[model samples]
Target: MTGHSAVGWVDIVVILGYLLTTVYLGWLGYQRTRTGADYLVGGRSVHPIIMAVSYGATFISTAAIVGFGGVAGLFGMSLLWLTFLNIGVGILLAFTLLGEPTRRLGHHLGAHTFPELLGARYQSKGIQIFAGLLIFVFMPLYSAAVMTGGAVFAATQFDVDFEVALLVFALITAAYVIPGGLKAVMYTDTFQGLIMILAMAYLLLFAYTSLGGVSAAHQYLTGMADLVPAPLQAMGHQGWTAMPKFGWGATGYDLWWTVITAIILGVGIGVVAQPQLVVRFMTVRSRRELDRAVPIGAVFILFMTGTPFAVGSLSNAWFAQHGPLLKGQVVKEIDAERGHALVGLMKETSPGRWEPVINPKTNQPATAPMVVVAHQPAQDGQGAPVDLVSGRAPTVVYAKGDADQIIPTFINTALPRWFGLVFFLALLAAAMSTMSSQFHTIGTAAGRDLYERITGKHGTEPSVLAMRIAIVIGLLVSVSISYNVREEYVIARFTAIFFGLCAATFLPAYVGGLFWRRATRVGALASMTVGMLVSLFWLLLVKAKEASAIGLVQLVTGGKTSLLADYPNWPSVDPIIIALPLAMLTLILVSAVTKPSDPQHLRRCFPQYAAPQATTL
Candidate 1:
């Protein structure tokens, strides 16, 4: 197999044309904007289709397609469970159970942001301020993850520097979001969602067809169970077509815990509390619109998440059949500074195709390929590297297959050149749609929720201007993180961190405020604070993946990867598993004892229920 070339002039022209169209749509949204409400929530009059597509687009970003899709490449089709949860929980349950109440509450209280909704319901400015700070501070980590996914693919497809791609991507998104606000964000999201559907549908069809259909692909992938990397097998990997070994109180349950607790439940449940997604509930004028949107959003999520997972897993079979083989000698060197062994030798002749490096002076391939594998430390801290394929000490690693690069490599090498241009645009759309919403949410959290509440200045124009400025600041923060964060396969990890944090901190309080009339201001505040603190404590001290990446645990413990490193399977458990239940328990216990909110405020928030009860009496 040969390498894919950098995008050609025709591709460049098509991309520029797409950008111009997006600019025109942004201008249309800007023309429609009139007041603070218009800027924050599209004047609460968005069409059902537009609202649904915007919600799905905001929910499914490059993080889903590139990040988690790459994860699917490493882990297997077991990721399909996440796609099921995305539709069942994220779309159906969210829209049916929570959407109407949130919309009614936001409308009745005149709340434009998620923090404002919580603050207004609880009648506590402190809650608003704290939530706003949380969002402004941590959301950048997730934004940077999304930005990294887009920049990685762009860098691969266009053959540009990753930093250059990230900067350009951020600037392009800021151009539309700062001025057009929610209106432009939704309009552009609708357009982008359409592109995503088309691209994913094509990719899914092509993957199965190229692999001799569904059964053939799965059968072949199942047959390659022996090809599972030795290290992965040691960690309980069964095969690409089957679930990881599942058990508790044992060492080999690491993969099972990671898959269930971190990947599936963390992201699946966390989507319900995402500020950007919740705000979309308030975009439409009525509950009827939400009902109309349910099916559209469900179908959109299915294509958005399902296609990527399926295609990502199928790529393993495609690569095994057609990918370039490594032919080289083994060489290993220990790097003392990073504490990892540099092993293997190979060179990329194209995006996904690897071969021996060519000697420029001699115009011939090197006698031995020098493949630079990602840094993976020995389990014993001995600085000995294991071969990815054979799981042997001090052997040649064949391919530079980072989990983050799997989807991009497959797209570039396995698909047709024309499809590359289409997928690039689709990925750009995925990144831009989500980034615009994120920047918008972060700005509102800073300007409308934090700054206005702090200064006691509620004028519409001032709030709008402050939000625009905050959007630029947020962009800078996310861009800087994207440029500087050096963790490998970080897209999925950072995404899970943000999502799990939001769920643990905000989900209990937000749900309580909507349904439990007796939920007190103190209870909401306490639940949020405890949830945030516990989640952070767990991430920095106990969760092995995040703890090691953060290095805070190592710094405090003098080289321990986690506080519970010796405890079996504890380090692999997601923070959400521990923190969310505690947070909910706190909310329930505290609310049961504290004074209930004012009856009149509850009446206004739940007017539909209030009238029914009043009539019955």
Candidate 2:
């Protein structure tokens, strides 16, 4: 636990080599890509395995490995459920249910982008253009969160400035992605995905071996139940073994509501409609390839998502055993701001709850340790914040209380230097792979879907150039937003927010358009609008993190609580749970009452009915 661990020259050389290889792949992609279709959808020729890996890599970025992994450290093994859902919903159902038809119709309509596909499906320019606008606007927030996660890890590992790491990341990613487009992005993603898989495999082995084994680690964590932070215990944390009880637990309904609704259902169900992930459905040659990809994607998701939660939870055990390593963590500003030096010398002035931390030596609050803390909204038997207000709390302080650093800190302190470097490359790969896709999606959405639709003009060369410009704009916007965000958890929250938003705004129309022939333009439009707006309102005014940051809820209520104060757990309810159902209901009601789309349009969109055999012979 020194000030900073030095990266080896060999490690530096390896990273440089990886970057050069990525650039070379991009050049290859650029050579292959002649038209907008090749750039956007890889000419619908991406191999199933490559497509599957690229999709998983894009789906699970550093946000999953670093941000959400850190959450696993705090929340425990319950996150494993998300991994299962990822396989079931994100990969299996998405591919089996949506992928084939999307690919068929997308190819049939010559729709190069996701928004364009939707527009062609519904025959509505507004749906296509507005979808593009949403991508241009909200996608940056997600891209920024991905950038922040990678930048934080890179800065910590390389001992470089955050801005420096971010700039280098942007440059390296933009170099390949801006020029080569989706083909290049996928090629590199395939490579990065392999690296990620290897690194995670090794990470899992190391994590378990370091703790004696999987069983041993779990046993140790279970034995150390007394060490589960008091606030967490109050919130129904049951060590690293079991799921928090659904209801009537010691931790009560708050933790249950938050975990089930926001983290689990929000992200789990949301992945089905994620544009970046969904776009992969169109990357391959046919439904057969999409079907072939399911197993590959399942394994990839299993390893990437499963390993992190397992390793992250076990790291809590490692940190508990080795307190000194905590000092090496890069203390986030939020944690630093909350730190206080005071350690009160209680003289048993009361029978239960003691006074706040105060230095007896100076008769005032000390400022050296700079203690930063948050309390769970729960009171102990004595009516005080479990251990935060003092009563048999551990005296030793971690450098940062922010849970987001858990994985990075563990990697830096616990892993071998060379392995850590390999892991860094893996993380960099994860971030860049996802970021490139995000930027590429943004480029295509804005350039092809929005700008071209707005002008009612389209051409390959001009559209390519416009997308390249859009890529640059996307990089700038995401980087700027990255600088403003400071919280570690917010990185994960942003992903959830975007996922929920995508689910709300896109899922209903997307499903209906692909299946039901009755879905009309008005219904689709209304669903998108209502779902998008409701999600925005919930995130900005109901959720604690964004709501507090925006301060709109505070302004209106003089409290952090959401608009639905009648329900105690309203704030914990994820927007997706609320907005997605409303969207579906609207889509159904409006489509039912208004008018069905033209039969010709349906016949064209669903070619199964108009097969060669159906031709009047």
Tens-place lDDT per residue, model 2, 1-617, is 22134667787799889999999999999999987778988888999998999999999898899888878887788889999898999998898988998888888888878898889988999999989999999999999988888887787677676788888988999999999989999999999999999999999998888778888888987775544554666767676667765673232556667777777788899898888777888888878898899999999999999999888788767654443222111212222233322222122235754443222111232121112122211122342323332233233332333455667767876787787788889999999999999999998888888888888787644478888898899889999988766754767888888988999999999999898888999999999999999999998888765677777998888775566554556666788888999999999999998878888878888878865755575
Q: Estimate every model's Cα lDDT from 0 to 1.
A: 0.84, 0.78
Candidate 2: C-alpha lDDT: 0.78
In model 2, where do residues sit more than 4 Å from their true spots?
248-251, 322-400, 460-462, 611-617
- TM-score each candidate: 0.89, 0.87
Q: How close is candidate 2 to the true structure, as a TM-score?
A: 0.87
The C-alpha RMSD of each candidate to the native structure, in angstroms, is 6.6, 8.0
